[model samples]
Target chain A: MEQAQADKNNSAIRPVLFCECLEKDGIVRRVAAALLGGYAFTWGFTALGTTCLVALGMGYAEAEVAMLLLAFLIFLIVFLWAFAAVRIDRVWKVLGGGAVLMTVMAWVMQHLLLH
Target chain B: MFNGFRIAMTWVHTWFGLVLGFVLMVCFFFGALSVFDREIDRWAIPETRFEPQPMPSFDRLLLPVLEQQLSPDEQEYAANMPKLHDAGKGPMTPRLELPVDEYWAYTTHRDPVLAAGGGFRVPHPKDPTLENHIHGRVTIDPRSGTVLRDDALKIGSDWFYPLHYKLQWEWKDLGYWIVGLAAFSMLAALVTGVIIHRKIFREFFTFRPWKQTQRSALDLHNMTGVVALPFHFFFSFTGLVIFASFFYFPLSHTLLKPLHDQHAVLEAQRAGLPYERAGVAVPMASVDAMVREAKRRWAARDMAGEVGFLTVTHVGDANSFVSIYRAGSDRVSLVGEGIHFKASTGEVQYEDPPRAAVSEINEFLTGLHLQHFEHWLLRWLYVLGGLLGAVCIATGFVFFVEKRKRQHAKMGGQGSRVVDALAVTTVTGMVIAAVGMLVANRLLPIDLPGKGDWEKWVFWAVWALTMAHAFWRSAPVAQGRLNPAWCEQCWALGVLAIAAVLLNWVTTGDHLIKTVFTDTYWAVAGVDLSLLGCALIAFWVGRKLMRPTTYEKNAVNRALALHE
Candidate 1:
């Protein structure tokens, strides 16, 4: 009976310890996602936005400036979303995946324009 | 991640604000001083204490100065010469023998001296298309064309102003990145703060200094944060925008370099300006006549102003042109109305048309933050806004520590103690360092070798000492008592501020009476008066801190009654 009681007590405490560790790790992941992922997404957005705008017959300088003006606002939004999102994986998918997709598209577009 | 959006937002606001609050404190405090950077420069360097002067006569005054062969800056030469010169092409050119490629001068409405520089071309460049020029710069008394000592640092502009944006950390632009991240965090904190602050309107007018420490700190934090919300948002936003192209998102010069170069060439072709030097030597036309014509044209456009910036590109070359830009002192924009003149013939090549809508917006955003326009009242308002930002951040630190110190003490955590020490160091310690630098400036001999460098050392040394003192006294904070360092440093700041003013009087012999009334030199007088004001406030705060808190006083009374 004492052995069973000890096992039960250990089981109860183990999950609590696990939950606390998970919570700390979650916070670290969220902060990293917010800053580093947010920066990547914003960089991609600026590149693609400027390139697309330039291809759409806007002046290069004006397009660059307009995109830069909007970049920080976009970064702020994504940064907040990174923390507020229910699923960390989804945040990463959106930020990291979106960054890659947009960056590739921007590169292709710039290549076409130069050609 | 939290129970609700509000809670989540609060978490974000509290943590991010706490983490970046230290950096934000420096940014806001130095940013406020940068408002009157030129005035402070006048106070530091008494030799430049005269009134603001317009651009000197270029033909007579600036020409002779520019004509003199000048050696490149030693630091720049050492850093750039190897990369710029190709040893395989031939022998390296001596620093003084480099050909002058460009001449430029810049001044603002608040400047008493003109800053002029020359870019000398490096021979045998590894990359022909790249700009391979070593630069030399000098500050001159525009009225007499006398060069000021190059070693004398413009403490305000060179020190405090850059400290706000870059923290004076130039190692691979580490400071820029740190400040940029801090600025972004500022935007996040502002947004999160709004979401968590449900009764912002109600808290705008609330301040209960008599309450407990945490409550009063939060009250002041909310009040100052709310009061300067717009100022805080816009300044941070514009600061990011100003450095966007150069530091934050350098797409134009990097990923878009090809397109950018193409556009530049096409634009030059359309504007009938030369994109490259002709290599053929030619006697330059009179720049004074070009300035005259430019002034006449500006007057015709009903925006007559002094020349704020003038540049001669491709100097001594056939395709060289002179660009004269009108000072935007009367408006909220930077120097504009640029008129290009052919250097060989002195005829107008192209007068710049009005800016497009996007360009105008860009310039306005940059200009407002830069504050080149002459508006005394607006300038003070900017200073007040900056101080409110500093106060908001400082109070945030206080509330963070006060809310956590007791709990952390119970838990045997040193988190609150460490934070409180840093808070004291940044708040009182920062002011002490700045004033200490000023006192050292006045106390140091005028002709001392590397006087400016010594002043900088004093600033860093004083700040480090204060940090040491704060950390040493932080032991009491772990026990849930106030760190006496805060009150002690406040007193030190008060003393240092007064000593700085008095030392200025002794060294420069320009006391309040002579500066404020006899001669009416507002620059020095204004700085002196502001220092006195700072000292008065510091003393008042120190005295208040010396008094027992209401909690302590009540405890003492209850103990006495129980004994009786």
Candidate 2:
């Protein structure tokens, strides 16, 4: 009976230890992704704002306003994406979408406005 | 009581530096370079004519010809160009005489009106539809509109201006704020470092190179930081102030502007203020006359050298004026008293001689920072001071990593890995980014669709790549030993520099030999050579560092023993 009890205790503790390891790893991954993602997103937002101003013939003041709005919009999108990526375990999808959207938007803005 | 305050300030100084030493080092290194930004730009963009030349009497040589060529309607339009100098009121823009295909560039004097009101100017088509003749540059012989050689001075200024701002962040107000914060942090670090050093005074005269690198680093750090403590503090603090508009104003806006109104107000402000055209039908005075007046004004001020700007204000109005400011003053280049003249009558209206005040203080600080005065001796001293600041920061960075490295090694696993990666990113990564962007500058076509802005993008892109690489590949210990990222970056720099030289030679048909001997040494050529120099330095450093070092072997052995 004692041997059986000991076996049950070990089984229960094993899952707890595994959970702890997962939690720590999850935290680290989340932090790293957020940092890197935030940085990339900031760049994308800035470029988008610049593009909007140039294309729209907006003045410097307007450009600044547009930049702020876009930055806020990007931050919201990123926050949501990160929440899903971290909380819901969709890291790859979030990172992939963020990268594509940022790069595409940046390139498109540059092309359309600059040209 | 003041002495007690002084004692306390000493303590404050010590702690501040220690806390922010590493970042300060970077700031100082970059700041030092920024001091010579114009010079660097001159060095970089070698082909652009940067220096001004005295024009022959335009009225005597080119005016009649231009008057004959210009249509009456075009002449009227040309008269709308802004005037040069003014009295206390404002400065004027120049009227372009386009008949000779030579633009009469006017000099503006120091006029209060120039700061407040419309400049005196006459507008014309900047582009004349003539290839290689569009510059509108003139020679002493007005008939010959020869293009002057690009001066070397402007390139240095161009390169160094951006360097001061730490081109890492997007070219926004925020980037400047970030730099300011970093500088403030450096100030903090400098203070803290002094506190941490128990033997600052004793160590001042002591530098033993044969001793441990750490000791030598510490000594150098203390010596530079301590000896130049006043300079470092003033510079860093003022730098913060200079960028205060970026940080303080924005934060204030955040607090003052309601969330919704901020965007609207900013937008409203972005719409540039309206400008009114001058309608008077009178002929303007000659630019040659203005130049002569400006020189006379400068002479009156006991100043020698050419005027920096000649300003004219209210071209057609009865109050229309011209102003001339002295340039190349040693102590305060920015603050000058100018002589203002009436545009219609060529009569002196008001005189503003230099006066000392808060604005003068500001100018003095800027003068100190810019070395506005052309005293080579003082300039060299400034350079030495700047280099010392760079050394202080570089050593601080090395020290930060070294300290962390010892601790990280004991911790083992990913903790050690992250630190190792950070070290590589901060030190080698920044250098790589700099060199990489430089290469991009030369390689990218000047008239490429987005080429004008590409240099900025290239810099940010390379930095981002390096940081990402550092973060990802750094976790594995063996990866640290390989330093693949570092090696890759070093190799990239070498390739980039080599490629730039080749590209320049191919495109310009002006290699080093032709540049130096045949076509006359160009300013852009200096940049290519500098790029080459950077590459050589990188290769040498990489080779030396990558080679097996006895010191590293011992360090490893020591680590193993400790683990045992």
Candidate 3:
């Protein structure tokens, strides 16, 4: 009874934890990053990223095919980076940066320049 | 050695591998079987392995067969539209489902051989003009004009081929997308795994077989992953590349609509037909004559000069075209050269020259990945690579469970238990289920309606039950001890594989003793011998797993004590 009372008293003084799951590295989030962040995001990213590369290579004759294959290889790097980032927030951030950059470039090339 | 960067990579590698390893194992195992898919098909359908006459004129044999199958009453071909089943032939109307209608779907073999159960694919009706999609198949005695055998069953190719890339799901290319995701995860795992394991080359030669469970499993995992690193990378990359068009075509349509349109324009320019269908009704000419003309042209160019596939469009219209392709066995490249003819006039409409350099390079890569050509040694190499991949994935699964199983059990290890059940199902359970499919094929009444469908149902049903059995038998959780379910299923695999071989011999009357020596169908003989070999291996592994264990009690107590 004395030991139980002492443990209860110890528990009362213990610090509270707000993000216990995140601190421990959330499994569900990690899985989401692997599937959604790594796969789903990389797919569209490759498309846009490669198209941007192709647009940039407009001066070169064989730009489309060469840039296209290179873009395929870049997709692997993007997938690894997504999964390797320490937190879910970081994965989203990296994906967002790529998405935004490609979208801007594609918009400019398709509408402003090509049209 | 395991610093921050390595730690992060390790986590990524482990999680990605765990998430998709089961899926990859299914793909790899089925892919290994598919390497010899035709051989297995020959073994499964014994009646088709007979010696066949030379490739007779298609009109002489097939015309009469089609006439009988589609009697005068049913000759209203253009009245109804064709439906396709993706089996590599034009679809049939409702009346075409008749037993006679089976001959409509016929495929010729690499050789002059043809059979009722194998060695044939579906062709279009008398017009022999259907869009490129494949539907059904039939094998016939080409000389007799009689229906020797006919069905849409692809016991070898269709059953196992789609499993590798599509997992047998036909949900609007959803299977491809799922596998693409798995393939993507695999690439990530491969990259991160190499980064974390800095001594990848050293691990290639390492194997600590005498060590405890955790050590050995990890060692095998590292060894297989590193040794077959090139294969895994190349295959994954090429697999993605092969389907890159599927994803990119849509993207191109969105981003570079003009280029996509220009591509179609160029293709039409080169094709000479422009895909126009004139409504002027006209009788289609003889495909046999077209095949002969294509063969002659190919011979003039010093090619192998045989037809692998024949496609026809606008069957009853004047604008119909007939395309003939060089047999896959003719060359190492997949996109073989072809000549298109006007179906109504039998005039050589256009001949596609050799593939351009870029297309040639792509075809070479795809050919290396697909291995439809007649090179036996390289095919075996592919099989070995596939098995190594299967081993790599299996060991990864084992290491995941073995490393943390004890600790996990302490926390009421629901996660680890679920993984264990899944592991057993995908690994050993898959083997037994595959064997059960063959056994069901042999035992089921051949004349039964929908025999092919029953074979597929049995395979899937057994697969599900084994998963259920693994969970049902192991759920009570006896701590650190190995699940006896593993041993039970291993025994089942061994028994079933061997029994499948025996059943083949008993039912077909062409046992190994005769097939190995007398018959030239090494494909049939090879499948039987391979099954026997698998049975021996399964039995050996079963014995090893059933051995006495010294770690059970400590494992149980420590895990149980975690909650207390």
lDDT per residue for candidate 1 within B344-418, as digits (tens), equals 999999988777788889889889999999899999999999999999999999988887777667778788899
Task: Residues A81-106, candidate 3: write the lDDT tens digits.
Answer: 65456566877776656566665665
DockQ of 2: 0.02
* Candidate 2 docking classification: incorrect
The per-model DockQ list reads 0.30, 0.02, 0.17
| Highest-scoring model, lDDT | 1
Candidate 2 lDDT, B1-564, residue by residue in tens: 112323323333332333344345446555665554443443334343234233335456445533343222333334332221222343332334322211333322211011011211323323322121212221122224332222212223334455566544554566666565566555555555565566888978887654445556667878887888778766765665454424532422332223224444554344321123335544557656766876776666676556554544443444445566555444444654666666666766666634434345655665666555556466556656766776676565444444334334445525435544554565566656666665665676655664535666676788778778877765544332434555666766677777777776776566888766776554445556766886897688667556655556767787799799
Q: Score residue B444 of candidate 2 by CA lDDT.
A: 68
Quote the chain B TM-score of every prediction.
Answer: 0.98, 0.66, 0.84
For all the candidates, what are their Cα RMSDs to the real structure? 5.1, 16.0, 7.8
Candidate order by TM-score, decreasing, is 1, 3, 2
Distance from true position, residue A1, model 2, in Å? Answer: 51
Q: Give lDDT for model 1.
A: 0.89
Q: Which ten residues in a row are the worst by lDDT in model 1 chain B?
A: B1-10
Q: Specify the poorest-scoring 10-residue window by lDDT in model 3 chain A.
A: A13-22
Looking at candidate 2, what TM-score does chain B attain?
0.66
